[model samples]
Target: MYETFYGLNGKPFSLSPDPNFYFASRGHQRVLSYLRYGIHQGEGFVVVTGEIGAGKTTLIKTLVNELSGDTDFVIGQIASTQLEASDLAESVALAFGVSNEGLSRSQIFNRLQGYLTQRRLEGKRALLIVDEAQNMPYSTLEELRMLTNHQVGDRQMLQACLVGQGELRARLQEKRMEQLRQRAVAFCHLGPMSQEETQGYIKHRLQRVGWKGRPELHQDALDSIYSETQGIPRRINTLADRIFLVAYLEEKEMVDRDLVTEVARELAEEQPSASDESEAALAGTQKMVSGQGEELMEQRLSAVEERMGSLEKLMDCRSLAKALIQSLQRT
Candidate 1:
């Protein structure tokens, strides 16, 4: 909504993972290197673990984009949340364009093997990337390990890459996964960017969307952002998006430290504040005392409308939260 006002070509701080907007920080660089090494070898699995919203999906998307032009590589990516062993197998089959409908596990495995072997014979390699793999059942993971056994002489017919949160690493250490751990060729843990990297990250994304610095960010403002978001990319994007909206609303071309702090405070207030709770209780009491329910309801709705009208100028998180609360009250 603020893009036109800020002269941006598109939304710069969207939460979705975009390969074109990928930022290669130090941690991401190392992770990419490991991924490259695994892809080059065409053998064992490469495990990547990170915190939630740590940009793992973005990294994988970037990798796929980079390798898309290569005719000799086939990459299939699947994302899941707490899937069963059979369900995961079905997902993997579907990801590779193999129909698993009403098919048994062994049947799906046979089809996957045939597909991988056909690709290998055509002088191409296949990589299956499982995102959010921490949710994969132990049996499913072992099934993945068994698939890695497919071989074309000295080379494996298919390679696998596991991308998930930090818990995947701990899960792999279990005795049940000993064979899978032994088969893993490389592992990398993606962490948050540094303070300096965070600054560059924001600038990089802005530049991607044709930002011309209409609202210049001060060093202190950047510091405030780093302190608030702790260098997490998603958090940084969220705060920066809101900060831009606040600036646009106030007609300020310069975003200073104070503005950042104020926006942060307002976002914190988006939750159920004490005053909001008291007002809710008071509204209930008024409803019980005054038998004229319609009049009191109209009064409350008028007050809510007035407050929301004022908030229309700044459509930030706090404003949205307040509108939602008032809407619930009206209902």
Candidate 2:
């Protein structure tokens, strides 16, 4: 909307994870190096974890785009969505084009194996990149571990890369996930950009879309952005987008500290107030206490219903067996 006013080509602070807009902060560069190293190693899992909006997804995407030219590599990317083991298996099968619809688990595995083997024989490597992997169930993760077990004469056929939020590292540290953790050949965590890096990041994105600096941004405005967003790239983008829009509407050629302060205050006001949060917490506590009795009662009733269902099934089975025995005697 403010493109013409700003005399720019396009939106500089778009929220989409576009590779073209990717900025490699120091931590992100390390992450990219680890990912490249993992791909070169070609055998085990590579895991990358970061906080929400830390640009881990964008980093992987940019890397994939850079690596897309070779016929000797196959990259299959899928975003996890709280899938169960079978569903995750199906997703992987579909991602690698394994024809898994209506197939049994064994059949799906067979198809995946066949595909991986075909790729390997063609002098190609296969890598599965799972995004939002923290939502992956333990069983599904175990299934992924099993898939990585596919090999061709002692060389691994399929490689797996897991990208997820910070909690994913915690999840992997659990005792139950030790097996999967042990198989990781590379691990990296992406952190927020530094204050200076944050400023550079904004300029980098702006320059990408033909920004000619018509609206001069003051250093104080950049400081305010870093303070408000804690140097997170996505947060910076969102706030800067708003600031730019406000600047365009006011027809200002300069973004000063005062304008940033106003915008920041307006954004703060848009958030829930302390009183609202307190009242919400109080209401939630009250509701939980009020519903406790009913919840317990419902749970007991459900247990009884389940027991009755099992007993009825047992009785039906016994009746069927008795009827068959009597019928045979009569015959």
Candidate 3:
């Protein structure tokens, strides 16, 4: 919505994992390298773990695009979330181009195994990439493990890459699944970007979409971003995207500390302070809400008048919190 005001070609901080807007921070590069190593070597069970929105999907999308037409390999990706074993078989069968009409469970399994074996015998490797794997049920996971039994005499029929938030690690360590855990040939945990990489991450994304003007972020602003987001790209982007609009609409090229703070307060998913109101405080909060986004109520923050402490200051912290909650929910 604020792109033209900022004079940009497109939105710089969209949530979609578009490859054209991808920026490989140091952590990303290392993860990509490991993924390359895993796929090329036909690692049996590759694992990529990261915090939410740390760009795991972006890396996987890029890898899939790069490997799409390769004659030596075939790649398929599935997003698993609370699906049963039969549903998972459907997902797998769909990825392998099998029609599901009137197909029995055993028939579907036979078709997948047959396809994997054919690829293995033809000197081609098969790759299955599962996203949000933490949501997968133990039954479905066991079904997945069963697929590993397909073989061309000795070589395995396919390799699998499981990508999910951190919980997947614990899920894999279950006592009943200890045998499957041993099959992992590669595993890496993706963390947030480093402080310096945080700065580069912003610039890299901006430049990808034809950003030619000087970056409007001050050094201090970037430092605050790094600190507030703790180098998490998704949090950084959330703060940055909102500030982009505020600065653009105000015709200010540079984003500053105040803008970042307001954006942070307005974009955070949780009200961390929602329930801190007495009857009097709640009444004052309702009044403060009507005056928010126009004025910051600095007059109430004189330290002399702020006897109610920092929470209410007539600043409408609740409104800011409410705005963020609503915005994210709409998304």
Candidate 4:
């Protein structure tokens, strides 16, 4: 919302993964290089794992953007979890633009082979990059392993890359999938940035969004963001987005330590503990209403609470609501 008021070409704190704003830290650059090597060598599998919100997806996006179209690589980026062999085949077929209608598993494999062969003839590479691969069944990963067997001498007809969170790497250690684990030619893990890097990261985004100079996010605001978000890009964006709105609405030129602490506290409180239900119960339940008066609000609140399965999800809703209330209080 402040982009227009602040004269930014785009939202600096946008949650979406945009390659344009990619801050290629030392870790990011190393991961990109390994991924590129796997693609160039036609390696069967390259595993890239990082902590949640560590920019794994953004890394893939940046990889695709960096690869020149001259390579004529047809990349099928699948975000779904692993499926049975048949489902894996069907998903792969769909990604490759092959018609899977009425085709059995074997038939789908044949079609995929034909598609890759065609690309090979055109001197192009066919790559499959699967995201969130931790949940992929060993059975489905076996299907991927089978696909990589399509080779003409030293070059594989199709290549596969697995992008996942840390859990996926842990999953790979299972004895059942040892074959697939052994096949991985390269692997990399991204970790949280150092405090100095965190400082640079924020300023980088501010500049990429077209700010000519620093926007005066306070030094402690930087510290709090780094501490609470642990230098993860997604969380950084989330907190910064809220701070952006707060600054705009409150007409402040800079986001300060106190503002960040206030926001963080509200976020921390929203995360339900074992005592939340008792507190809710103790607060007093409303009289059971049936038809109109106030039953609807009660019903909606209950449903919202039920749907929020994680403390993180619940915390965000509370954070936003608390911000609104605080805004009103100041007024």
Per-model RMSD to reference:
19.0, 10.7, 20.2, 19.8
State each model's CA lDDT, in order.
Answer: 0.89, 0.90, 0.81, 0.82
TM-score, every prediction: 0.79, 0.84, 0.79, 0.80
Candidate 2: residue 312 lDDT (0-100): 100
TM-score-wise, the better of 3 and 4 is 4
Which residue ranges in model 3 land beyond 4 Å of their true spot? 269-331
lDDT of 1 by residue, 1-331 (tens): 7899989999999999998999989999999999999788888899999998899999999999889999889888888576766666577778878887888878887887788888898999999999999988888888778778879877798789999999999999999888989888988899999999999999999999999988998999999999988999888888999999999999999999999999988888887989999999999998777868777899999999999987875678688899999999999
Task: Please write out the lDDT profile of model 4 over residues 103-189, one tens digit for every residue.
Answer: 787888788888888888888888888888887877788878987888765668888899888988898888987998888888788
Against the correct fold, how does model 4 do in TM-score? 0.80
Ranking, lDDT, top scorer first: 2, 1, 4, 3
Where model 4 places Cα greater than 4 Å from the true spot, the runs are 213-215, 274-331
Best by lDDT: 2
**Model 2, stretches more than 4 Å misplaced?**
273-278, 284-331
Candidate 1's C-alpha runs over 4 A off are: 271-331
Candidate 2 local Cα displacement, residue 135, angstroms:
1.1
Residue 178 CA displacement from its true place in model 2, Å = 1.9
Better of 1 and 2 by TM-score: 2
